[model samples]
Target: MAEETVSCPVKIHMTTEIFQEETEKIELVLFGHYYEKGGSAYLKYEEMQEAGKIHTVVKVASGRALVMRSGAVSMRLDLREGSRRPGTYENGYGQFPIEAAADEIVHTRTGSLSGQLSLGYRLYMHGDSVGTYKMKIHYEEVQAAK
Candidate 1:
């Protein structure tokens, strides 16, 4: 696949404890880099929240390491469970409560990390009922254009 450059503004909030007991002070950082299937970048700072503790809201930077702005990003995931028989599409739209769980990862020049994060969303299914789904995403903060 061709290389595509995209800026991702990541905001991480932790409420768990790092390691086994000690609390942590989270430091959010923004970095600018080119992302590819097998590419990586570095963090502006080395200090981060404790290894296993959780943090409230950690502001990583003034805005984006590459730029600064206020915006919103949304990712949609569609899970297709195997049908009972076959040739039958079991897809409907309505009010579905979606429960998504995601984790944060920092792909630095040195290495990559995998953490545990919990996320939730409301999926609209049929009628007033909703579907709760799970989600897992790995990304990092990036710089925004000035």
Candidate 2:
């Protein structure tokens, strides 16, 4: 059987909580695509900011998830069950190493190609545990106009 695929309008709402003190939120409505193949699923989208455009790709596999972003701020994060991965955070000024340990990672599809993702992880910088974070992503396909 061929894998399923979907493409439609999407609204992305993301929040960042750092050190259990700082919080930031970004909500954007744009077009995105979702597809599943070879036992993995992918979500592709783009984010626009004042500095530049950020293209984000999210890949989901069994017991693992990866989020990659390129543009103004760049990062490649790996979230595997009970595993720690080293990543780099880059900006115009400089770059630094980030250690990410995921406590739990889940990507579930409620419909054929739409669902929510929830992740909980610990973040370390400079080899020191900085904080813990929880990220949730919920999206659905937008209906087309008549």
Model 1 segments more than 4 A misplaced: 1-17, 38-146
Model 2 lDDT per residue over 10-73, tens place: 5555554444566554445556767676777777888788879998888888788888989998
lDDT of each: 0.27, 0.77
Error of 2 at 121 (Å): 1.3
RMSD of 2: 2.7
Best by lDDT: 2
How far out, in Å, is residue 85 in model 1? Answer: 38
Clashes of 1: 32
Q: For residues 78-135, write the lDDT of model 1, one tens digit per residue.
A: 2222211111112122222332222222222222322222332223423222343232
Model 2: lDDT of residue 66 = 87
Model 1 lDDT, residue 49, Cα:
29
